[model samples]
Target: MSNSSLLKTAVLAGSLLFGTAGATVGEEADARKILGSMTEYVSSLDALSFDFEEYHEIVTTDGERLGLAASGSVALVRPDKIRVLRRTGYTDTDLAFDGQTLSLTDSDAGLFARHALPGTLDHLIDTLRDDFAKPLPAADLLTGGGHGGLTAPTAEIKDLGVGVVSGMLCDHLALRGEEADWQIWVAQGDTPYPCMFIITSRNIPLAPQYRIEVHKWQAGPVEADFAPEKPAAATEVALADYLKGARNLPPNFIVEVEK
Candidate 1:
């Protein structure tokens, strides 16, 4: 084989496999063991609810990119419910999930937008594939795989070692995706939390880079009221009246079918 061919083969071999037969050998063996243990720690979770503060910034070229620094309080009620309230300097946007529908209300703009919610966890994971430009393959949590109600990631993964993230120790998830290579840091040591996840672009335009940072998390029911707190200035109309006005809009005005 040529030098280039040989080099490519070596890298592929490494991504697919990790440890080799040995009586009492290297660091690779231990990392594999921890990845499995951590996977189980994460997969066995039944339902989880957490509150977080996310700072999102997106800068696009043709008015497609959203760039702003914001701080907010968010609440997620397992299976499918999420509420996000953010203050972007002078404006506030509330993103709420009500089982099957998501409401995006711009408090300052005086506009309300809604979208269809993804039904399943696996589907939500798939939805992110296009947005991040990096594929999340099928697998189980313990084996570098995706975990949900009925699906999982089927990627080959090797735990390198225990790495510190956000002041906690976590198992490093290093593997290959369907469209490109990937890396995610899973909680390992004391915290039992997902430290961070990053997906780099594969074959897409607009220099896409997606990173998710999970801060303080509380995995259980909490005292949170998700009732829509509409601004007092918003035109008051009965639900029946609002529904009447909605009928005048285009069919399926909430979530649009991509052309």
Candidate 2:
């Protein structure tokens, strides 16, 4: 997407989310159809690459809101290969999964960690979220599941009609889950792809949010994208040991110990 389009999309998204009209039943049904088609379309891909900008909102103890931003890219291959790189003001990190092992690199710190794991993309997400408390960048949209498992019984969904995202026209859909409320904008037409996603934490004060804007997409990703390049001078460390001292390993990064 071009810079002009991205600006337009961002402006339109803000207006729609905070100022749009209420949704009708027909709009809701259309949203479901569009999202279902999008899931199918992404599932058929053998590999994919896209650039993303992530934003995080935090509420301070005194009720002041602060925002943080990061930009990154994701590369994925079906079954069991993926890579995500994110750069923030303080650090740059990369996570890679190669079917057999999951590796994380803290480039600025010259530290790397690896864990023995074998699974599909879905399994990797589950492991990261459940055990490591690390959510993959835009995992909900790109995963091979209907609406990325957003159609839960407890979720209240609605379609917010046409909106722009990354300068592309999109169908906006909102979902209120038990813990979070999320909105997604997917491009329309034969190649319906997601352009943006925003999630608000309902359980937190002031409803802090995490927003992601997708800037570009590629149909196929080369092997090098998911393959890790270990720095010769980087120290090899255990996942636990590495995470112990790691700061901001990712927004929700946590190391869990099992009894």
Candidate 3:
């Protein structure tokens, strides 16, 4: 696939999560409890790992199905480190995150690109569970109006009924933002971690979905790798020259492009 397609995948995968409506008096009480517990569960997460197998299919507005594609063993360690390494029908690609940088290296295309992480490790955990597409609602749920970042739905007021998600029972809720709408389901009990999330755009013809599962967790003071030997100099002559002449990079940050 082209790099733009991959970038769309990445940008789409990590959207914001939030409640657009303010809750009512009695209902707000219950919603607050559920939302609070859910927050605690996520806030308490640290040093965990997840391994997931993903299936991706992109059908453009024109009704072209790129066809069903799948991958195995998508792994991650908290604090912005991820590795999508597996054999599959799709492109052979390597995506990694050290604590500070995100890199995508397409071996088949001999291309690589990197960008800086805007915040601390906790932010990454919030991003991971959002979805394969990272729907914006997921991001808002975490940022919550601090430091001029995105805000999440208070979902505390919606009279969302119960539903079965991926064989697990959960409370279903609906929320809308200025730019999007969300349908999310979470575990019914205390600390309701998101079982599934879906997002739809109001102004654009884009509807993307993300399903997240906590496949596994590993404990430690370990970090993910960011540097895997710079791209081959000969292969990246133009890119290297471009970087050498680049400007305006944030302090303590790195920029990488692979092609």
Per-residue lDDT for 3-122 in model 1, tens only? 999999999999789663233334446644555555555555544443333333343444354333445555555555556666655566665655665455555555565546557444
lDDT of each: 0.50, 0.79, 0.48
lDDT of 3 at 10: 76
Superposition TM-score, candidate 3 onto the true structure: 0.53
Better of 1 and 2 by lDDT: 2
The candidate 3 region of ten consecutive residues with least summed lDDT is 142-151
Runs of candidate 3 exceeding 4 Å displacement: 1-25, 51-88, 113-119, 122-159, 189-191, 206-259
* TM per candidate: 0.54, 0.83, 0.53
RMSD of 1: 10.5
Best by TM-score: 2
Residue pairs in candidate 2 whose N, alpha carbon or C atoms collide under 3 angstroms: 5-167
User: What range of 10 consecutive residues in model 1 has the weakest lDDT sum?
Assistant: 134-143
Candidate order (lDDT): 2, 1, 3
The per-residue C-alpha lDDT of model 2 at residue 170 equals 92
Q: How far is candidate 2 from the true structure (C-alpha RMSD, Å)?
A: 7.2
- lDDT of model 1 at residue 247? 26
- Point out the higher-scoring one by TM-score: 1 or 3: 1
